[model samples]
Target: MQCHQTSFTLSTAGRGPLRLTARVAECVRDSGIHTGLCHVFCQHTSASLLITENADPAVLRDLEGHLTRAVPDGDPRYTHDQEGPDDMSAHIRSILTGSGLTVPIRQGRLALGTWQGLFLWEHRAQGHARTLVVTCFGTAAS
Candidate 1:
């Protein structure tokens, strides 16, 4: 078995999901692990990771809309707004989603569905830099 890990920084434009499938796939390819699990983790509390549809932009919009309705910023109900009204809301959104993801890898590639895409969801109102760590572990190619 072999293990490979790497980290990269991404700049988010604001509060939204940014596609990461290709970037993560690059890591998988670099790892040279033919079969096993790929673990992706975001080292932040105000952002998250998820697998969602890549075919339609409307789906992403709807997801953002849902999150906006479910966790509105400046709701006057949160107290941890040191970084602005979106502070606590961002944290909530991250918790609601997640900070890590695990995907299967086969034949030295991600085994994602045809329309499946990996994304990093930024929950803040302002743009910020986020870091992601990807670890690929399993058998090495012969």
Candidate 2:
């Protein structure tokens, strides 16, 4: 069996879904793990990872719109706004989504669907560097 792991940082401009499909696929390609599970984790409380449609941009936009409406900022009910109105809301959005993802690796590539893409959903209003850890382990290619 083969195993490999790595981490990367992404500088987000603001609140939106940043596609990371190619980046993650590069990681899988470098791993040498032909068949296995790749675990991708975001090391942040205000950000998260999600796998969704890559065919159309509207899908991503709608998801973000829904989340934003579901948890608006400046609610005044939240007391943990030291970082700003988005502080608590960011955490809530992350909770609603997730912090990590697991995808299958086949033929040394991510086995994502034809229209599936991995994304880093930044929930904050300001830009910040987000870190992602990718770990893959499995049998070597024959």
Candidate 3:
């Protein structure tokens, strides 16, 4: 059994999904783990990760729109406004979405559906550099 870990940083523009499928594939390919699992974790409370359709731009737009409506910022019920109106809202969105994603690896590549793609969902209204830690573990071909 072999285990490899790596990380990447994303500078988000705020409030949307940024596809990172290719980047992760590169890591998996370089890890030399022919068959394994790829676990990507977001190291932030206001951001999240997801594996959703990457073929259509509208899909991402609609998903973002739905999340915004479901957890709109500046809500009167939220009291954790230390970071701004979007602080609590961001945390809520992150919880609703996810903080990490796990994908299967085969032949040193991600075994994802054709339309499925990894994405970093930024919940804040302002941009921030988010870091993601990726861990790959499995047996290497001899």
Task: Give the per-residue lDDT of model 2 (tens digit) for 58-137.
Answer: 99989988998999998888889999999999999999899999999888889999989999999999999999999999
Per-residue error for 8 in candidate 2, Å, reads 0.8
The pairs that clash in candidate 2 are none
Q: Of the pair 2 and 3, which is ahead by TM-score?
A: 3
Give candidate 1 regions above 4 Å deviation.
none
lDDT of 1 by residue, 1-142 (tens): 8999999999999999999999999999999999999999999999999999999999999999999999999989898999999999999999999999999999999999999999999999888999999999999888
Q: What TM-score does each of the candidates earn?
A: 0.99, 0.97, 0.98
Model 2 residue 134 distance off true place after TM-score fit, in angstroms: 0.4
Alpha carbon lDDT of each predicted model: 0.97, 0.94, 0.94
In candidate 3, residue 119 scores what lDDT? 96
Per-prediction backbone clash count: 0, 0, 0
Q: For candidate 1, what is the lDDT?
A: 0.97
- The reply for model 2, stretches above 4 Å from the true place, is none
